[model samples]
Target: MDRGHVDAPEGLLRIEDCLDADGNVVLPAGVTLISLIDRNIANVGDTVAYRYLDYSRSAQPAVFELTWTQLGERLRAIAAHVQRSAARGDRVAILAPQGLDYITGFFAAIKAGTIAVPLFAPELPGHAERLDTALGDSQPALVLTTAAAADSVRGFLAKLPSARQPRLLVIDDIPDSSGADFVETVVDVDDVSHLQYTSGSTRPPAGVEITHRAVGTNLIQMILSIDLLDRNTHGVSWLPLYHDMGLSMIGFPTVYGGHSTLLSPTAFIRRPQRWIRALSDASRDGHVITAAPNFAYEWTAARGVPDAGDDIDLSNVVMIIGSEPVSADAITTFSEAFAPHGLPPTAFKPSYGIAEATLFVATIAPTAQPTVIRLDREQLAQGIAQEAGEGADAVTQVSCGQVARSLWAVIADPATGGELPDGRIGEIWLHGNNVGRGYWGQPQESRRVFGAKLTHRRSEGSHAVGVPADGVWLRTGDLGFYRGGELYVAGRLADIVVLDGRTLYPHDIEQTAADSSSLVRRGYVAAFTVPANQMPGATTQDTTEQLVVIAERAAGTSRSDPATAIAAIRSAVFRRHGVEAADVRLLPAGGIPRTTSGKLARRACRAEYLSDALRLR
Candidate 1:
């Protein structure tokens, strides 16, 4: 395997430059994650590697701390145990919560030369279906979890068929052993590292086959893009370990030789202030860097500033917002609410990424403020991003940022498979080493999604420009446009609804409805399109598709007057999006389906609605 080297553009620091006078690269190229951990132990053994906290236990919220030396020893011991049953290339499922144990088990799987499948613990109701499906798909040789979750994991696994059952191992019960005697295994850069499962928002979840090369390259891209090298960077996160964002945060900091603090997702949700407080504390030492989805910023902003008088300091913090649609209003609200607490507007970094691209594709420059544009709604419906004056016809969009210097992006017409001009909304196509190999056990899908090529064609007053015929591009399935050298994501191609020859994005309609009524639950609404024939009060001549919205009602809200709620939703959709929903279903809280990453499962919700399975009021 080749230890790929990145040719950093002028004025940018190179990864190899982070070496000593002896020309020893701090993080050697082609090195596995285990090697990174060992190097950290050798260099900074006494430094804290991870700190896990559980706010549920008010008496003792601080759970545990692991130093570099201790973490290396623990992971090696777990690796030895795993190697006894699993061989190189075998899959090992990790059904653990967000804690130090999950991190140890995951790295240990890598050290044991087995593919790690990180999954959510079966503590939540209705998560068994998802767990069972993942187990049947991956067919792991063994499962690893913490002592606290081992019983729940076993109970869920008992219901599975005998053929699909996997051996269970508890990390906390593993006896301590000297890892120095353990034999180290060789792992190649091109070898499979793990299977990152998709969110399954629009379809059934499939495993994305990610290689060590992709992981290493993406980490380099992110580190360089954010200019974290030689900087005082402290990592903090509240995202679940199962998601790509969370996994990258934990793993990337280790590779960078930095300390990270983690908190449970439930704790963060229960008290958003804890996340802010963690950042404030970390800022006392150095600049704090953390990442979360867009909804987290909204949730924290909604909590309002505490009355404790400017106790929090966000001046030395860089908050990355990604993993979902970037809301301009959310960014504005968060910045304004925290400004009194010393939060700078430029600290909020809006980014764009996906599981297929390993993790990060692009992020705004650290010194620049995030770009938010208001475009004409009518022009946007026609696949153009013309600027609109201040009025109700303007649609606000936040730019994900410029493409990483190591990667390339092109906007392509989905229908024609040809590249589109800048500022035109179309499918996003990416090309870079960070892109994953393909989906696991899915040859057809891999080829179609990862091996896409551009088709050259001539049009009026334009000559055909041929792209390299041998180069393969990753079809991102996301619709966006380029403006001023930055990417602005419009919406997903699969979630676009067409009505009366006009294109409408579900996010726009859902946002409008959520803001229309206080009773409707924010971020819990889903919008999709159904055939005109399937909707009542529509004639056969109505060739246009009908809009359908299913929104969850806030808890403790009265459902006795469904008619009024339905009318309000309809009015909001028409007033904002210029289209009326053919049907509006107001369901109780938790009625709408969401993926493990907290993304709206529009396709699943649509399926349930069509089957009359949704609990409608």
Candidate 2:
């Protein structure tokens, strides 16, 4: 593949041309996020940028509000403090919980010319390992945390060797420096903005090196794709700040010069109604846009807001369900459950995104309801999405919409690295200005993951216009197909289980297992395959892979007999997918591990299971 530079369109801004003699970035009209923040502060200083609720305060929630001007001032002060210890291009890690402090620290790192590494706080359960992995990978010079978490962070750092420990700065302790003179660091569009660590659901986490240009362009693409420019868009979110989706939901609204109301994830998990209520309240001023993973919708649907009365109006809400498998059933159930309260079916927007692309990929248009396609299961397993007959064995898959106009998407054969036609299942490949530079530090891995090129020519299919002959493409390890001009995600290539010369998706098996019994926790089951040789009793002739199912028991359940639950799971798996599990293990609540973004960490769970670390009943 050719690696020569291709001439871009005329009038297109290049990062190299925007630098000054001192190597500092000379600010262009509107190139970087810093420019956008400055514009928002100057034009709409008084407009609320963020409103957060602190449920830890009292019986009723305590609210905190930050306007654009206040946020900018705080960011400047934090930036000054951060610059005292770290130089430009250094990495600064943020370990604070979800609150204003975390937000300030994040933007402050960017303002100081340091790549911000957003990480879950050490206080969160099961986060120590992930935080350790991130810290070692990013090698940040300084760590930022809230006062409440400072001690905990310090204690965690004490466990690490002195050479690897980083200086911690508590955001609450940073003094006000509005009157102090501080030179704002210049920012280039190509400057490394932040390192967004992938949620290691399938593999170990890697820091995705996102540039200012990518972030700015992605925010623009999202605004244009969702048509939020002309509307009065207010935001509400219950997602954790560490995750990209959560950050974008809050960060993008501010970039678009709109207000965002944030609720703690704990609050949402405790009472799913809090999320709906926040959206309902925010809609009074303007239209609300909120996003969450698929399970949250099912959780809210299971616990309906029966007492909300007629005050709950989701008519002006664009609810985004993403970050995991998009379930048509979940969308239908959530819409039907809240229809009495004025929630329209069109409000449901199914989206597909990853951390590598700076979050906002393909999302259904705001005007249309999510499109669901019914395909034969057998055909789908055979790498072909054929429409099922009226009474045939069909599975429903939701469309994630056409690729954003700013980005180019193609389905490619993973083994051959050749582009496949539409309706053929293959790996999803993405190319755009929004794609990140590459993973941090791991050059070999980075090139392998981000430097993909399609070698074969396609005679028929929807192709990206103006794609360079040798442009680099991002190989999204996901398997999907394009049908009806929209993208339908099948499953992760690594997660597909091959049994008896047939392919099976883990989501289907997990869904069946969850539906088998009420005692089983939804979204807490993991299905994976183990080599036959790794099983307790297997011979060399047993070349077939062994299927292992690990599920979490629901709370307050008296199902002490594992046999009953195991039998139920076996029966369900056999009945639904014509497959039998080689092993079934049921553990107590919170048994299965999950990423900070609430995705099942199947690879991690499998590792623990093989090591006999799981607390089996």
Candidate 3:
């Protein structure tokens, strides 16, 4: 095993510059995550490596701590058992609930030199099909789970054919003494580490092959970009362990030999205040680093901030808002709501990333406040980003900031693959060492998405490290543009609804519809297009796309005349976006389909609406 070193820019902090507790640089050149774990165990074995908030049996959360030595012992014990059943480079599926066991199982597979598939338990509602798809694609040789989740794991596996069923291994059932028999496996920098399946927002889930080099590089990139070089940096997260952003919490702490406190997603959803309390608690020791999607910030501001006590101090926090479309309104609302509790405006760091790049791609600087600009709505519909003066005809766009230090990004024409200059929206293409190897079993898709080359010549003024001569760009399907050295995301290419030769972003329409009626749930609307034949009355040769809005009615809200609410939604869409809604379907709360990471699944909702699968409120 080799320790990796990053050739950071002159003023930037290098990977070897990140010091341990005694102010010593222990990371070497070409280090893998496994070697980092060993380094931490040797240098800071007594320090707390992970702290999990367990709320399974009580209203108040109980904290569980794992020292570096303890964590290493558990990893070795679990890896020894995994090595007995699975060989190197084989897939091992982690089907445990979110907690310490999930972390143990995931890293243990990596330690055993197997590609781990981080996924949720089958008991998690509304994600059975997603889990099934990922499992079918990966076809793991072993399944890792906790004793409490063994029954659900078996039940889920029973639905699959016997040939596809994987051997089950209980992580907690293995004793710590088993580590004595553990044998270290040699792993290369480019060895496949894990398979991060896409969240299926735009399409079906595909296994993105993340390598050891990618993981190590991305961790360093995140550390440098966020400026979390202090030894006392603490991370607090409530994200699901399976998602790409959530999995980053594990490696981030290990790289710096810092401590991370994790909370389950259900715990935070049930009481958003828990996330706030966790951050406040973690801030007691040192600077706090946290992240969540835009929706969580809105939810916390609406539900958690009002009830927060006066002693809640968020002055030392740096929160990253990512994992979905960044919302300027959400950032403003959250900052204002928490400002009374000592949250600074600069704490709202909006980032942009994808699973194909091993999680991180671009983010605002650690100390900079999130940038928000209002663009002319009409011009934006035609693929322009002109700033709008004081008027209602403007759409607010948040800047995702520059690419990470070692990564390069450019906006390219989606159709021609030609590079687009500043202020022009196109598919975001990225090139870096952190780019994933490729899709697991789809060579054609791997080449199409992860092996793109710019059709036009390169442009100057990139802030990132120079790309290798053989580097190929990974084409991110999300649309964005560059302005004043900052990247501003527009929307997904597939989710755009074209009506009468006009391009309309679904998020813009969905926001208008949600605001049109108090009965509609915010962040719970899906705006997409239905074919002309699917609409009530249309000719087969119309060849025009009709806009459809599916909204979830807010809980405890009812309309005496539902038609009035529908009329308001239709009127608002036309007044704001200049488009008439062909159909507006309002359903009970939780009607809209969402991915596992809580992003709106517009394509899936469109399929349900077309098939009449949703029941009206």
Top candidate (lDDT): 3
On the 0 to 100 scale, the lDDT of residue 489 in model 3 is 86
Which of the numbered candidates is closest to the native, going by highest TM-score?
3
Residue-level lDDT tens digits of model 2 in 558-592: 55777788899999888878888999988888889
lDDT of 1 by residue, 1-617 (tens): 11133243232234665444753223345666666677778876777889888776793477689998889889888988898878899999899988999999998998889999988789955456677777788899999998999999999889988998889999888866746545688877778788888888876777888887778778877877776664357788998888898889887666656778999888888888888888888887777889977678878888635557648878778888885568887788889888888787778889999899988888898789988888898889999988998665888899888776557778889988887877789898888777889987889999999998878432531112323566788998899988887888888899998888899888888888888888887777999998876554456765567789998887668656767778999998997877878889888877998778777889888877767678542
How far residue 213's Cα lies from its native spot in candidate 3, in Å, is 0.7
Question: In model 2, where is the ten-residue run with the lowest total lDDT?
Answer: 1-10
The lDDT per prediction is 0.80, 0.82, 0.85
**Clashing residue pairs in candidate 1 (N, C-alpha, C atoms within 3 angstroms):** none
Model 2 TM-score on a 0 to 1 scale: 0.93
Sort the predicted structures by TM-score, highest score first. 3, 2, 1
Error of 2 at 232 (Å): 2.1
RMSD of each: 5.2, 6.4, 4.6
Model 3 C-alpha lDDT per residue in residues 470-585, reported as the tens digit of each score = 56899889999999899888889999888888888889998898889988888899999887787544557664678889888886775445677789999999999888898897
Measured on C-alpha atoms, candidate 2 has an lDDT of 0.82
